[model samples]
Structure formats: structure tokens, C-alpha cells
Target: MIFIPLWQRLLVALATVAAILLALPNMFYGRVEVANDARASIAQGLTSPELEADAGLWPSWLPSGLINLGLDLRGGAHLLAEVQVSDVYASRMDSLWPVIRDALAADRDTVGFVTREDGPPSELHVRISKPEGAARALEIVRGLARPVASLSGGGSSDIEVRAQNDLLIVNLSEAERAATDDRTVQQALEIVRRRIDEVGTREPTILRQGADRILVQVPGVGSAQEVKDIIGTTAQLTFQPVVQRTSNKDADPGAGNILVPSVDEPGVYYILDRAAVVTGEDLTDAQPTFDQNGRPAVSFRFDPQGARAFGEYTGAHIGEPFAIVLDNEVISAPVIQSAIPGGSGIITGQFTPEESTDLAVLLRAGALPAELTFLEERTIGPELGADSIQAGKNAAYAAAVMVVLFMIASYGVFGAIACVALAINIVMIFASLSLLGATLTLPGIAGIVLTMGQAVDANVLIYERMREELRRGASPVKAVQEGFDKAFSAILDANVTTFIIAAIMFFVGTGTVRGFAVTLAMGVVTTMITGVYVSRVLIALWFARTRPKTIVV
Candidate 1:
């Protein structure tokens, strides 16, 4: 019999009801947030200000924060980023590879290196074919490695250049040492997001494109160039010891070729010649305001230790110019006037309100833990979103009408019952998405329509089997029961496979693929439950009440 245990029956009823309830918010009340120009606001999280276009449509009873359709359904920004983890790693390795090659070549008799095309440990092939002085060669090779302070402390490292038979692996180059960490993808995304947020870009869509790429979509953005700038800037801030002043140093001002840039051009910053004494990482807060003399300036606070260090340094260096450098550009170089005991100080530059705000944002976001460079970028706007939504809707309606008509023709009266269940299934799917906050994409709409067509698969299997049973002269009740019983396993196998594919699509696919996959996966699940179990219950209730011995066609 197609009959389920009472518990199974109750569970189905409850699940079906819950799915409907969950999707209610998205279907009715959820509105896609729009930018001031009624376009998609991709980088919404970046900006603090509200755009003119953010409006919500929701049931009066829904919570104020609860209702809003996502980009998946309403056709908002969609981007696919391919994380180039390997690319970045290779580029870094290439930079240091040459240096290591040169070092080894210099000691050709003792050590020479080669790189494998593909191998584990990302090894470099090495040869100690001729050992003029093996110990000295190894020492020089080791000296090539500098301590990776971020990795740990108090240790010096030489580049991993040693002979294992004919091959020696360079452990990691200076550049590669910075690159070898796991979680590069996550770190890259966070840095990109931080840059976007600093720019006050609104509703930005940032997703991992592949293993190493990032897809970024910024809606309500005026210029893609500006968005690109924000994404690309490294903002590598440093604090350097006030280089010991040499008398007459001001005559040349270009000491040792450390060309300091104008403070206004934060992008032009570079490293100072002297060693760093403190860094932006120690900065607690920064604000754009006037100093004691009332000139355009910035006041910065320091950590407990930085405060002590700064106080001593300023106190000793009174009457000497302290360079306020950012990105290697001297925004301000003011002479120490007095011993400021406090951990805080000010730098007043010829500045504007806009520049001040930008600086403030950058400082607030915190400096990137390491430098970052963009390999790729992708963007989609609201105009495209609207067009996609319309196309999706038309396609959906057409698919639905076609499927509904086909079902009626194929199964006659039983098809009519399935059709009613199909409509319920559609409603339940939407309600479930609305509730779960699932995003719907063009592919997702296709999933819905495809599932709609296949919703009848289980019902068709049962009815066809029943007809065969009836033809074989089985009793009507037994024929109906056996039909469902025999078809259950086949129905399960077919739908389960589709669900697995959908799951993979969601996991491996980012952005739109994920949205579509999720919708498809959910739809397959809903169809099996509603199409098979729900329809059977309603049909059984009908037959039991009527007790028809010979069913009319």
C-alpha cells in the first residue's frame, strides 16, 4: 500500500506546513533594496549613508527588520570571483626565485637549484654537484632567508636551499614566505572587503570566485574606476624612527633616495630608509580636526606602550622635525615644539574635508595585515537585474502552463488531482524560499520550473503501476496500494540523485550558481514530499469515502 505509518504521515503534514510558513516573508514582504537611482546597491555595507532608493515592501504584521528579498530573487548584483591563490603564490615565488637562483649560481661549485614543474611541498630542485665549500655555501644559502617575524619570534631563517641528492628545495623566498599561508582566499576577501568598506561603497557583493579569485559587485557606485582604486590600494602603513638628523641634511632633502611623496597623495607612499619604531597597528584612533594653533590637522592616539615610546621620542627630539609618513609620503613634517607627555599628538596638513574623511575611513578599517593585489574583478548593475527578473518570470510562467497542461492530458482524472497538488507545491516552494531567505537567480527559476514538470513523476509512476495491477485483475484497493509501494524506491533514487547534483552546484559554484543550486535542491526535496505523500493522502481520503468498485474513466 502507498499508505505511510501514522508518524510518517504526520511528519509530512508538519513539514509541508512548515515549508509554507518559512517562505511567507520572502514571497510577499521581502523587497530588494534599491540604490538612490533605483538601481542595485552592490556594496551597501561599505557606506554609512542611506541611499534614496532603499525601500521595503512587506506585510504590515512582519517585523520591521524581517522582510526583504535578496539579490537572487529580485535580480540584483551577481558576481563570480575566481580566487587565483596559485597565481599569487607563483608570482611571489617567481620574485624570490630569481634572487635564490642568483645566490646559488654565485656558489655554482657548491650548490645550484632547479624547480619542479609540479610536485608536493612546492619544492625547488637543488644540486650540490660540486662542493667547493659545502658548509660556507649552506651558510650563505641560509643567510638568504630572513626571519619571518610573523611566523614566530627570535629566529633567523635561511632560504631552504640544501641538497637532497641532486635537488635542493628553497624553503620559501622572502616573498614566498609571506605567501605560503593557508586561508589566502579568506584573507584576500577580507582585505578586499575592508578596502571597499573604507571607500564607503554601498552594498558591495564580494564572493570567492573559484579556489582563489574574488568576484566583486558594487551597486549605486558612480565610477568603476573609483571602486577599483579602493580595491587595489595596499595602504601598507608604517612608523619609522626619526632618522638621526645630520647637519645640512635639509640641503639635499633627498637623503639616500627615499623620495617622500606629498601627504595629499596617500597612494604615493613608500617605505622610509630608517627602521620602523612603531606602526599603524598600534594606532587606537584618528580624527580630522584642528590642532592647538587651529590649522587643518589629524590627532592620533596610541597604545600604552606606543604612548610611552612616543612621549620619550618627542621629548628628546624637541626642535627636530618628526616625519608623519603614510605609504612613504610625508603628509606632514612638523618640528617637535615641546615634550608632550601624553600618548597623543597632531599633524596639521593643508587638507580638505573630503580628503580628511577618506583618511579617517582608511585608518578606521585598520591597515592590511599584508599587501594585496587584485587579479580580477566583476560587476553587475540593477538595469541588468530588472531585465533578468522579467526574463525569468516569463520563462517560469510558460514552463508552468506547459507542465500543467501536459499532466492533465497524460493521466486524465488522476492527473487533475496531481495538478492541484502541483499548485500547492509551487506555493510551498515560494513560501519556503521567502522564509529561508534563499536567493533566487535565473538558474534558480529554471530549477523551480524543471521541478514543477517533474513534480508529477512520482504520481505518474504510481498511476501507471496501478493501471497495470488493475489490468492484471487485482482488486482496486490492492492495485492502488501496490502501485505506490513499488514505485517508492525508484522515485527516491531519481530525486535523490538530482538533489545531490544540486548540492554540488551550491558548494562548488559561487554567486548565481549557488543560488540556483540551492533552489533546485530545495525544490526536489519539496516535490517528493508534497507530490508523492500529500496527493496520496487526499486521494485515499476521497476513495475511502466514495468506496467505488469500478472507477470510471
Candidate 2:
């Protein structure tokens, strides 16, 4: 007979009981999900009588986690968006002008007066007031270049400045462009994640695709357009010094200033200073609140550095109008009422409460580095997901009944022990998934059915070995012991090989393939424990109590 130690038997029993308890919450998945959501809402300070009562449904001491249903199961929206990375190049060149101007001005003796010339959006052209000074001007601009900040990019400046005739041509270097592209994609991904998280949507998938695209999926969201509306706005908030306000559309504001049309008033344009006093990056917090006049407004607080800068600027520029620009348009140009030292201020834009709230959320989430163009959008409905779940359930039930009946008919009493172990294996698989917060897809259900067959295969090998030993006239005890000892190697080898395959699929595949691999890999582990160890223990216990001289196969 197999000499199973007392500790091993106790350990198996303990694990089995723990798994069943942990998996019990999944039976009440809807209630647990509601409780979790209500708890999250309470933590966010949004409390209601209904929410509190719902939260009370699941006790705090109990494990309330449920297996997260993926998009195919719960139904939601999917969107693919490509980031306009080239847009950053223009802005980069525009910002480089001041640095170039200051650099060239330092060598006034060698380089004469410099002026920016209109050129292609990708290139910055600087005109040397004196044609002969182009070489010196180019030298000075190139000297300003620093090493690119990237692991793969060696020592190379961000931009390459070369002299072309009387103009200095400047464009982003190859290494610098790669670095900027990576930074832009990462920034866009984070911004999208934050925006989705603010809405309290559960398990939104935001990942970078290729060189310049992002894939976003939000489960339980109604439509793709709704997600777009939330994250589409650039929300490029900037505060600029107002140069002049003009009603004439044809007025020339000259260099170093931009003409932006007013957002609140029609046919009015404001010439604002190109350099911003402060941008949205300086904002620490923002919320939708009522202004002094009880109108919907956005209240914002600035970081420490921003507070000091704003205080100094407002103290010196009292009575001057400051233009608040959003997405390159002047929203309002309010005159400085007084020397306001505090960093907190309210913005009134004649907005509805919904608009105000949305603006505040955008501000808090930060701005996207580049604009995203929607390439594809799709919405999956709950009805389809429900149908899928029903089909999967039927298939699982059919598979389970077949496996159970086959095991009972083939090995009789020993087959019944294997059936008990198979049930525990299923429970353990779900418990492990719940503990790990793994998502379940239709393919994952298929993995479970596949595990059922593999689970019984180990039992078949053991029973066949015992029958062979009995045919050789070996005693019952020796037959059982030899059966388990011989079958152990095959069981271990088969499960190990299956585990390796599942691991490879998980790492190499995406989406549904990964879901399948997760369940399949987990099933292998649970089967090894319940199938080999638990089955052996059951047989050993039966033999200890009933030592039959001849066993019925």
C-alpha cells in the first residue's frame, strides 16, 4: 500500500477546504460586485442610502472579490486611436525659437540681427540680417544642442542646425525624433488611463500599439462615442499676457504675438503674448464649484512654484487683462482686479454643470501630449454576452456529465474517487482565478472542459497499472502500491509538458488567447494536486479501513 504521511493528508484536506470557502463568494457574484462598487463609491465620498445598504450586503471581513468578466463576457466599447505625433514637431520648433534667439543674440559681433522666416512646418528657418554671418549663426545654434536623453540613442543633439545660404535651417535629429515619439505615446497612454479611471469604470484596457497608436477598451460602457467625448478634448489650458484686444479681423499684431479668436464673443480676436505665464501642468487640483454669483465654474489650485510665479506676475501687471486660452482660443480676457497672492482662482465660462464637471475632470487628469484620431470603434451589447454565457454553460454541463458517467462506469469504486477529486479540481481552479483577479472569457471555459479530460487521464493510468499487477498474481496491497509508483512518472511528465505549452501561449498571445492560457495553466496546477495527491489519499484511506483480499476493478 502507498505510505501517505499524516502531514501530507492533513495538508491536502486543509487546501481543499480553503479553496471551497474562497470560491463560495463567486456563487453570489452579482451581489459581491455591487458591494465592491458601493464600497468604492463610499471611499470616493459619494454616499447615498441605497449605496450604503448595498455595501452592507457583503461583510467587510469576507473576501468580496469576484472574477473580472472580460469585454467579450460583460459587453462594452472598444476603440483604436492613432496619436498625431507629427504635431509635436511643430510645437517643438515653435518653442525652440526663444532659445535660438537668445543663443544667437549672445554672439552679436559674429552674428547680426536674427529674424524668423516662414517655412515648412517641419523646419525652423532663421534669417541672418547679414548674409556673411550665416556660418557663425549656424555654429552658435548647433552649440546649443545637448545629448539626447535615451538609452539606445548615443551622443546626439535633439535638433540639427545647418546653414543654408543666408538662412539657418533647423529640424529634429533622427535620435531625438525617436525619443520624442516614445515620450508622446507614453504620455498619451497615461492620460487616457487617468481619464477612464476618473469615471470609475472597472478594468479599462489602455495599451500602446505599434509606434503611434493606442488601444482602449472599457467594459460596461455603453458606446465608443461616450469614451471619445471624455478623452477627446485636448484641454490645453494656458494663461497668457494680453497684448491687445481688437474687433478688426484683418489687424496685424506683428511678431512674437498670436491672433486667437475669442471663444465667448463672436468676431472678436485677441493678440496674446506667445509665451505663457502658466499652463495646466502647474495645476495641482481642480473641481467643479459655484462662483460668487452662484454660476457653474471650475475652481483650481496651483502648485507651490506656480503660486509664487503667479503672485509675482499679478502684482506687477495689475490692471492688465490676462487671456485664458483653451485649445489655442481665448476663452476670456479678464482684467486683473487686484494683486491676488493666493494661487486658487475660479473660472466662469457660462458653462452648464455637466460641462463644468467634465472640464474639471480633464484638468485633474492632465492634458494629452498629442491629439488622437479615432481609427476604429465598436460596441458589444449585453445581449450577445448573455447568449455566449448561456452557450458556454450548456457546453460545460454536457462535458461534466459525460466525464462523470464515463469515470463511474470504467473503474467502479476507484472511478468514484476520481470523480470526487475532479469536482474539487474545478472548485480549486475558480478559487485560484478569483484570488488572482483573473478575467474570464469564453475560451477560458473551454480550458476548464479540457482540464476535465486531463484530470481523469491520470486516474485511468493508475487503475490500468493496478489491473496489470493483479493479473500477475500480486497481492492487493502490493498491486495498489506498484500502480501508484509506476503511474507517478507519467502523470508528472504529462502535466509538466502541458504547463509549458500553456505558459508559452500566455506570453505569446493577446486578449482571448491569454485568457485561455491563464485558465488552462491554472487547471494543470489544480489537477496535479487534486488528481494525483488527493486521489492517492482517498484510495489509501479506503484501504486502511477496508482491507479487502480481492478488490473489484
TM-score of each candidate?
0.66, 0.91
For candidate 2, write residues 382-418 as lDDT tens digits.
8888888888889989999998899899988899999
lDDT agreement with native, every candidate: 0.62, 0.88
What is the clash tally of candidate 1?
A: 37
User: In model 2, where do residues sit more than 4 Å from their true spots?
Assistant: 1-3, 59-61, 249-256, 301-316, 337-346, 544-547
Per-residue C-alpha lDDT of model 1 across residues 74-149, encoded as one tens digit per residue: 4333334444455444334434545655776786655543333323334444345554455655676677777654
RMSD of each: 9.3, 2.6
Candidate 2 structure, TM-score to reference: 0.91
- The residue pairs in collision within model 2 are none
Error of 1 at 197 (Å): 5.9
Poorest 10 consecutive residues of model 2 by lDDT? 249-258
Q: How far is candidate 2 from the true structure (C-alpha RMSD, Å)?
A: 2.6
Local error of candidate 1 at 507, Å? 3.2
